[model samples]
Target chain A: MRARFWIVASLGLAAAALLGVALGPVGLSPAAVWAALAGHGDTTTVTIVQAIRLPRVALAALVGAALGMSGAAMQGTLRNGLAEPYLLGVSGGAAVGAVAAIAFHWNTVVGVPLAAFAGAAGAAALVLTIARIAGGRADVRLLLMAGVVVGAFANAAIMVAYATAPPESVRGALWWMMGSVDGAEWQRVTWLAAYVVIGGGALIVWARDLDALALGDDGAAALGVDVERASRRAYLAAALLAASTVAAAGLVGFVGLVVPHMVRAAGLRQYRTLLCGAAIVGAALVISADVVARTVRPPAELPLGAVTALLGVPFFLFQLRRLAARS
Target chain B: MTAAIEFRDARVRYAGAGGLAVAGVTFAAQSGNITAVTGPNGSGKSTLVKALLRRVPLAGGDIAIGGVTLGQMSLRDAARRAAVVPQREEPAFPMTVREYIALGRFPYASVWSTSDPGGDRAVTAAVERAGVGGFLERHTDELSGGEWQRVRIARALAQGGRLLVLDEPTTFLDVGHEMAVFELLAELARDGMGVLLITHQLNLVARFAQHVVLLHAGTIAAQGPPNAVMTGGILERVYDWPLVVARDPAVGAPMLIPLRAPSPVTVHRPMET
Candidate 1:
């Protein structure tokens, strides 16, 4: 029965991806999509499908998958259902790192994602360090508060940088801040794919350890898990996945929070299954949301982050109420 | 001649807003013996088990297992020698009973180890022993409290350790399930496993456990066999209530009875006429 559910879900996500790739204002028919995929379309058609739409779709999948898997690992380790990539300060730290790079115009000298990567790693370290200093391993509440403080600090820093930059750079930062896949090149997708594959693969390997963790730290330790070591490794992996995705796509909030819960609610419980299922569903959700953002106003676009919250807010509210009722 | 576990001057201090919960506690468990720690609610019974397992770091002293200091052994190695079944646990995610039980194999198997028939046999045996063989496929969150407690005990059993430490293992259980758990532990002890059971159910402890340690006010009030330690004086002092301790006529075990306070009478006339 579990296998059958996964098959159905996988098919649904594949169909969503194909549909997202095919549907746009210019409307490539299924035949055109087939031809473009088969590498026999005209130059203009090929550019629209390949250069413009394909990279965007692929980035959506990569970032979405990274967010979902990391979210699962985070929630499992913390033993808190409300845990997410952003709530842990990975996103905020990465954003701080990226904004600092943009403000310094590091992209002109170093590269786009490299600066973003550095910033994200720095932010992750900062959050972990602060969390450790404040409350030890049991200081989960303190860590969450630190995340909020760090996120606010990063956003303020981004605004200050935007205010001081050249007018051209200001528009660039604003666009990036709005989170469009409009100019997603093959480069961002490639790097993100590599990171997710490595990081996601590690999470799957540690799936059983994750199961032990759900039993609370003491219970898990009693079961023979090196509670501290497992937690640290899982946290590091989750941070890497979230940080890389943030570096690629600007802060696409709540995909991490939403996708894992949705998959679990659908009865996917095993870590291997949950991570795989959440990855596909997360990709499908982002790609479809991006399509809506682009088509809602026809050539004009909405921010991808805004679109994510539209899908995320209602589900989050439902979850909160459900949890409240359960407890 | 070898002890399965030994706590020499082991102390656990919870640095709450107030102060410590346990001062200095020392104990030992020999192979093939059922040793229990019994005390009032605030007497640091749980703290003793946590200190032995290194779940909470010791505030002062050292704990050794098989003559090796707990600090010298890795957490995984300590787990191999000792496994703990907590009184209660809440898992964040819903997992199947079998998957939850299989987590006991965490210390035994490596990440890349193959799932062989031998592994399956051990897990099956543990499930049968813990008496949850019928509910392996059910969701853990859906089980009744007693059933959940049994499942956790089963998981600890499956860990295949020589020393088993349990904290109030019978908290949510009724007469039947509680006896069932104690019976299982007693049987395991007969197989040469050292059992350190922390329970508030003094009756069961008096009936089954081979040795007893009574704690009061973060210190050891008394320690010995049930016949020696379940005295009325210790019970009343530790519990802060009037109580009676006598041997049960039917089972030849100790029994406890609390004496309720008398109500104040407004009209004070001597009954003696």
Candidate 2:
């Protein structure tokens, strides 16, 4: 099974990398794509592939993987099937931070990514603090409630920013708000890649803690697990991974929520395997969605968020109906 | 042998409550014996159990397991020495009976490590011993009340602790299941695991428990063998009602018959100076 996972992951990375280079406005054929990747193609094709589309593709894959792993970690820690980074208020918080940074024109010193990271961290802190104050004792139900309240407040703040921002800033802010990988740069992709590797690695290593949590607090505690410590570590890792994704790719909705559920529904429950599988599937899902978003309009670009929502609504509706039918 | 559990001047005070729930209670549950804590409602029987497990904070005094103070021992080590099945605390996860029983092995597991295979074998054996082997594959939440309680017993058995503390283990069980659980407890005591249970079932406690400790208004009202403690005088005083206690011929256990519902006094005398 481990070998199979590695084989599949390698295949996915290869396919994504290949497709990333081969599919663009200036389409490089597979042979040319390989040649350009190997530093043997024409200057124009090489520059467009290397400088423009490759970075976006890399950014999408990295951010998608981060979101996927974090979603798995979040769900596992809470022992809830529906938990995700968005459910923890990280994405919404990051969105608020990014939007605030853009609206306030704080792009000169450290840029929107750092601002977005700070925002996500702040949101996570607030949700955790409130849940603790409520004395829910880190119970899954209370964490979810905190997420809902925090997400709502963050959305309200975002609306206020959108509602009151100057007309010129709104267009740019809206683009970020809508979630786009269009203008991704190598520097941003590198930052996101490092964050995902570190944060996702931590989750994979803490997989056993998730298994312990599945047994509830006493069971976990009885097994020699410091339940509080395990949960806190998982929460911090999930928050950081999520914040980095939003920092890199803006507020890409549903990728985190959708991927983990899809993996669990497929009968994979182990955290390490679940995280790995979600990462692959999430990256593929987002990349495919991006492909559709880009191709749906020849000259104009549609908001990636719109495309994801358009696709996600049907998937979500289907899941909801199935759940209702089961009940 | 040092008792598996000792409550020395133990007191449990709940938040926002002035008095101790189990005040100045001292008792030792000896190894290879079943000590039953029984009392009327709101008499702090459960409080004493919690204090022993360190689940509730003690307002005063000390609780020691195997002569090691619970306060000094790490919570994990304390768990290793004792396993508690709280009154009617339901399993919320959708894990299978085997999985639920396997949770008894958690204290030995590391956060980043896989479960020990030895613990897994012990859990399976414990389930089989508890007579829930047939229901091993079923989801825990799907089990009937009797079956669920038995499963909880299996988990406690698998915990491999010196003392098994149960709080109202038969709360929702029918008569047959209740008897079945008590029989199982008797077997556990024979196997040298000290068993302490908090219960409201006086007749069952009289029949099965080797020792009985009665609580009234957060203090130990009486403690002794069942034959000594299940007297009519103590019953009437504890319950604030007239009651009769007599031995049943078939089971040779003491049984109770309440003679009157608290009939209020008809006339009041002047207060004594």
What lDDT score is found at residue A90 in candidate 1?
Answer: 69
**Best model number under DockQ:** 1
TM-scores for all candidates: the values are 0.89, 0.82
Q: In model 2, which regions exceed 4 Å deviation?
A: A1-21, A24-35, A99-118, A121-146, A159-171, A307-327, B15-22, B40-56, B87-93, B232-243, B257-273
Compose the digit string of candidate 1's lDDT tens values, residues B1-273: 768878777677775626566777777888798999999887888887777656778888788887888889887788778888875577887788998888787777777553433667778888988889888999987898778888887888777788888998888678888888889889989999899999888988898888899998678899999999998988988887678998888898988987765544543533421
- State in Å the error of residue B191, model 1: 3.8
Model 1 chain A worst lDDT run, 10 consecutive residues: A169-178
- In angstroms, the error of model 1 at B187 is 3.1
Model 2: chain A TM-score against the true structure:
0.84
What DockQ does each candidate score versus the true complex, computed on alpha carbons? 0.52, 0.30
